[model samples]
Target: MLAASNRLAGAIAFGLALTLGAGLGAVARGDHVVVHRVGASAPAPTPSATPKPTPTADRSGTVSQQRVRHIAEREGFAFLRPPGRNGEVSRWDPCVPIHYVVDVEIGPPTAAADIAWAIAQVSKATGMRFVDDGTTAEQPDDRRKDVRHTKSGWRWAPVLIALVPDSVFHGKGLHADKDSLAYTDPAIYSDEAGDAEIVTAQVVVDADDITDGGHEDPGALGPTLLHEFGHLAGLDHVHRSGEIMQPDGGGVVSYGPGDLAGLHYVGRAHGCVADAALPTDSDDFPR
Candidate 1:
């Protein structure tokens, strides 16, 4: 137990991983991409069951599919469901709240506001609750973690939001590629129903991108934060010019209609189970 406590306080290895963009092919900007490779095994296919039709209604913070489809078609949307995998992008189980731990050291002043606003937006858009589990000294790691050391009082790893120097990352070469602002690597896993859900994630910012982008780019930090969290929410880059999920620069500090549309699609699954097991120790999402 003493050794485990020390281990929690020590440097946790952050393994090298292919950029999440690599999953969609090499799309991360610049040269400094740092995606943490989580589990390497594929989840066993569960017994086949009928998937219900997608929902369409605005209730308790969720938007209607009619509205989502309209927005998706008009503003454009990127359907990044895994390859050879059919249908829409996977989602979190809305039945339970997603708890996150934000490392308060996220820096350069406006960090707190940006983090708050981003999380609020995601919660509002998805109808999925996100309760902040406070700050930590933890650095991002790709491996599975002890949610919390019941005996030692070490907090479980949550969604990390760290401010890292752009010069230190692979996607931040010329200072700002526009696309180098921030990135998220969601630690995905399967729920009881054999569906994929984002159990934990990392939303790291490139500090130099804001610094190099010049004066008061701090305001722009909100969008980058929102974009990274959007990744945590299971969104991929859309070609649309106005959406927050745009591969390049986008229109607002807020999520556009299309971004919300995709969020609507990925917020919750069509089925529910009587019980669920927390998925950190598991492998890649259900296939």
Candidate 2:
């Protein structure tokens, strides 16, 4: 869990581990160490684009696309798997719009607006497109299915961001340590060539913590959401202060220069999956 002396200190942490069957799994909190595990599993097939006769709506509501871009970078950033000889960094396909949904059943009154704001922030930083599927009563699950049959049709499950209570948080296998404001579980699959893509993810925020912070105050729910979203975008914790990817919040309310650079590295401007080039050295990764 991301620990802090107080909310103002903005504690956060992230962890990564390999799993069998479907894809790689990673978990993030605030202020924790990252662990990696490797084992052989059949490579999952790459996701193909939605077939013809696409539905106009999904579980979140009417589907619409929103895209933004902000390119910049510097030192003091890191990834779950830094780009270079180690392997390719896993990211969402830039050419496709990422669809997401919010579960606000246990959230504060401002939950919806706060989430929209944070998503926009991440979208701008990463040049990723997002489609809000609106709200759902769906709960967070570590073993959530990657694809589900919806009224529109069968499609990849949209990212789920749930505001959950302590009971649900502990019960749902979110693995949130004590006092963790939020955590993320991202599912990544590698193709035959060893390239990886994040297919779906879950973001679970502690409802009690947000209530205590009143959601909108500095070092409150907003920044926490942003930090977890960073994890969702394939970033891991950095020890540097002033970066949103820092293990602890470091009193930073937004993505710093290093964070922007990291996002750019995984974002559309870097290249979409089909045409994206692999980084060849440590210089391609954040220092």
Query: In model 1, where do residues sit more than 4 Å from their true spots?
Result: 1-75, 83-88, 143-156, 171-179, 191-194, 211-219, 268-287
lDDT of 1 at 170: 38
lDDT string for model 1 (1-287, tens) is 43553354342211111111112121111111222211112132221111222223322222343444444455555433331122323455666777776654746676677678888888888777888877777665434353444333333356677776645433423222233555665554443333444546667666555432312233366666766676677666665666767644353557878888777667754443222333212222111
Q: Output the lDDT of residue 94, model 1.
A: 62
Which residue pairs show backbone clashes in model 2? Answer: 2-30, 10-249, 12-30, 12-31, 13-29, 13-30, 13-31, 60-133, 73-261
TM-score of each: 0.61, 0.67
TM-score of candidate 1 to 2 decimals: 0.61
lDDT of each: 0.50, 0.58
RMSD list, candidates in order: 13.0, 17.4
TM-score for candidate 2: 0.67
lDDT of 2 by residue, 68-145 (tens): 111111355556543322335567787789999999877777788888888899999999999998988998875465
The 10-residue segment with the lowest total lDDT in model 2: 11-20
